[model samples]
Target: MKVFICERKMEVNYNIAEVYINKILFSHFWFHLLSLGLRMILSCLSSFRTLVNKSNPIASRNQSC
Candidate 1:
């Protein structure tokens, strides 16, 4: 009957929506993780640069008697 067909169509639409939402969530999770990793790497690089600069200036300074 028409009612049974309509019910089937709604079920199919619900399943399709669920799949789409899941894919969006999965991609969001990866994007978040990637950004966090990049932030950590950038912080590490900046700290190393500071350490190198500090050491370089101290090593080159002339000692006063």
Candidate 2:
């Protein structure tokens, strides 16, 4: 009876550990994905700004030239 009780306690501990590890892994995955998305957004915005700046002078100078 004692051995059975001990085994049960160990099983419960193992399950709890597994759940905690999975939660940590899931959080890390989401964090990496969020970081990647932010980088992509920033890259796109920078490109758009460059394009706007490049065209602004051309459009303005055409009237005088």
- In model 1, the clashing pairs are none
Q: After superposition, how far is residue 19 of candidate 1 from its true place, in Å?
A: 0.7
**lDDT (CA) for every model shown?**
0.94, 0.98
- Tell me the spans in candidate 2 whose CA falls farther than 4 Å from its real position: none
Candidate 1 segments whose C-alpha is farther than 4 A from its true place: 62-65
In order, how many clashes per candidate? Answer: 0, 0
How well does each candidate superpose onto the true structure, as a TM-score? 0.83, 0.81
RMSD of each: 2.5, 1.5
Model 2 lDDT per residue over 1-65, tens place: 99999999999999999999999999999999999999999999999999999999998999779
Distance from true position, residue 28, model 2, in Å?
1.5
